[model samples]
Target: MSPTTLTDSSRVLCPETQSPQTARPKVTTVMVKTPRVAAISLDYVLYIESAKNGPLSRRQGLSPIKWEKIVPSPRPAPMEADIVSFTWPRFQTEAILHLANQRKALQAFLFKNLVEGNLLWLAYIKDHCDYGLAVQIHGATDFLNFSNAVYNAFPARVAVKITMDNLTHLAYEEAMRAHFQHHRQIAKAIKSIRVHASVTSLTSLTVVHPDHPQQVMEVLTKDLPEWAEAIVANHPKVTTRMPPQTTNFVWVDGRKRPTTHPLDAPPSKHNTGPEFTTPRNRTAATEPCSSPSDVDDIEVIQISSGTAATSNHTKPMAPASPELESHHMETYIHVAHIHKGDKLTWARLLNHGIVHWLFFRSSSKVELIGLGFPIGIA
Candidate 1:
């Protein structure tokens, strides 16, 4: 399923790294995998200087290993300070605390006063006559994170449950509004991998939901697009233009809406404008027309002295249209229905203001209706 450099190198190193003879390794600890096959084991050896060398003193050849099993030592008491019941004159916690004067001193204190394990075998290195190395064993950490070095050596196998949404067909811009979509099958698999403890070298992890594709393609098979871009850059410059982006705000009542008013006649109690202001909606429309308005233009009729007008002054209103009056309930719609024969009308919407949307009647295949309002209002 996955490859590791350590495993690759171990093919050669494992054959050469045989245990030395004099160091007849007595198994102190054995960590087994499924079916109880030993995956890792630790051994210890103690030795004393002697008058003469033993038969195992020569480091040249591999004789049969003298294997022996010893009774497991008593499990050590928990390392927390236990001054609640004193064994000597001074508090045990206070005496223990004094040993933590330095890092090495603290380790020495733990090795001397705390350790109590089986000493099954003994050997002395010929070169170094007196001193011998003492080895220890550790296992996987418990729920808490206070494990020694050996315990943390293996990737902490932990399962973390997580959630994913839209496990299938996602519409355009769906994630912005979509919420948690639980896939029971996928969740069952994700619970097997611990975030920081799982094997880091594995190239991929399979998500085993029925909806998930058999294999996800994160890497492309070829780099043709990058090669194409590099070739194109060496030629003459080709000007590229991107059309303006069009966004539509459809009326709740479909295409038929109250002109210059909220779509579907929303109540005034809790109503507010759209979250983002369009260019047309944020500014006033064009100034009043000097002549009778054409079908292609909207005229602002001086209906009344809008809040600032003097009482005595009243400006003449522009001639109204029967069609426009019915739609907005006020003045005419700026720019009447565009002629179907016009060339540029099909290319773009109304040019008098910012064009945020273009209305299409695909069923009927009729002339496109262009709403030329600052904010799609009447």
Candidate 2:
């Protein structure tokens, strides 16, 4: 059979038994290249200060920033009183140089602490007397140059003098060996080494020896160090002193103190257990001494096994002498309550207790014949 033919505007079709043609859509892929970005680093210093205005301002204004360099504060200088003793040079040349350095150190200290630097003094202990070098300093540079020069040092010879009022005939000879060292030129720098014990640079306070009424030394009390002042104020025999009022009245944790004094109020007790006590009392006792000959001293003894074992032989030990077998018996009874902050009082009590216990335990005259209990305070 022949196929029939059909005509259309878009395509011509033949009536043949076959599948119909379909169009496939075309696809085009696009490549997008991204630009590379580089990292940027900026170094800058920033200083901030408290702002004077509010958080935001309506008007635009230019404000200039100011920078000020920071300076560290100077530490306090060591006081002359704190220097109890130092090794003095024996040669005249070395001694003169030593005094010059001392004067410089004193001046530096005064300048650091904002103290008036008018006078310079270098004091030392020699011949069991207080002697010093006092110089009136009008200018720091001129004074330094005058003392440091080795040739014709201290042109103004009248300003320099040596004190020898307390020096004995023997002491004067010894001091000459130490200070002058057989040097005529250096001796001329010192106006005189006459008998003069007073220090004229500052007002001197006399410190008398407790045992010797004749032995006395003078010190500059106005320039005493903190530690020396503390020792003097807290001495056991001092009676006219009171507890520091400034510390007692200061606010605690930035809060106002109540109307009642803290010591006057009843303290609340905290019970930690039976190991501690509430009362504050202490007692000590010692056993009565017995004649050394009446007590028998045993050094050692062997322990025997059961009767099943064979009998063993042992050597008998001789009785020890009373001096060799000496022992002391003492009992300490302490029951007290303490707080952690009471360190000073606790230290004093502990020192007394240890001394008492040591006296009996270490004594060589006692006889060994008593039971011992531990010495302690609860």
Candidate 3:
């Protein structure tokens, strides 16, 4: 909406320049020149606001989509302390981050999100804020000129001075992780990089295994282009393996097992027996033999295996209702990794549970599956 408009058609006394009698007469039609300001759509405004926060982390009380829908858009809040809604970036970063951390990211976020344009004019309109950050960014563009003059000219890759002291020892683990993370940072530096790292533009990724530098070099040189692998030959031939990482064990049905898989699910193994030991109190007791004959048969059957074992034995609980379990199993089963939708469905705890169990198992979730004996509610 135009906050202000000038209409020459309205009969009004001019200030000191003209008295009431000298007022301009109403005309049949009046022409007014509207400044050709680049009008941004509401979508662009929200994009600018959301860009301040990092990628959608489930840090805000609401997810990215919910935050966008529920949180107020960049238009000023209706009232102070009114608490109607909050957008992701505003609520997560600007509203909560420490002043120092917030300042480091700064109003530069606004300019960074903006495309080619005169920022000053835009900032002039959004003059009020917790900080005059947006306006300051527009002011800085004249002097900083970061997008066009500074960043574009920088080299895509900087050669690391790879050395034995840095790449080979336990002390160097942090440095190596940092080195890997440094490469990750470059990918996030630009939108194109963040979406996908182009092999041509990416720096030769140096993999220096202290003891196996030669092997590391061989693999990289073979997989990567000559320009990307130039430093491989010069890298010191070393004699050390990567420091071993401390292993974490996951508890399932109460048994603890060292987990190697990304999802922490153990490889399936054959049980070859009617019953298996159950960990106490954590999961339902191991399912028993379906038939009395199977109890004596001792036939080989494949079942998921885990590491830890206990001496106690018990009968697994039979399904509360097989049809109900089947319905739940068929529905609400998410093949994908944890997503907002999966979380929403899982939180409801619908009567059907087999699908929920399958989802938890598939997702490698141990805690939220609720496999233990059901608790009675008052």
Model 2 collision count: 1
Q: Candidate 3 — which pairs collide?
A: 71-86, 210-240, 211-239, 211-240, 329-355
**TM per candidate:** 0.13, 0.13, 0.13
lDDT of each: 0.27, 0.29, 0.29
Better of 1 and 2 by TM-score: 1
Candidate 1 TM-score versus the reference? 0.13
Q: Where in model 2 is the C-alpha error above 4 Å? A: 1-47, 51-355, 361-369, 373-378
Answer with 1 or 2, whichever has the higher lDDT. 2
lDDT (Cα, tens digit) per residue for candidate 3, span 112-227: 43233322222212222222232222333332332122123322111101011111244368778887875654333332212222121122222333443232211211332222
Question: Any residue pairs clashing in model 1, and if so which?
Answer: 260-378, 280-374, 281-374, 281-375, 295-336, 296-335, 297-335, 298-334, 298-335
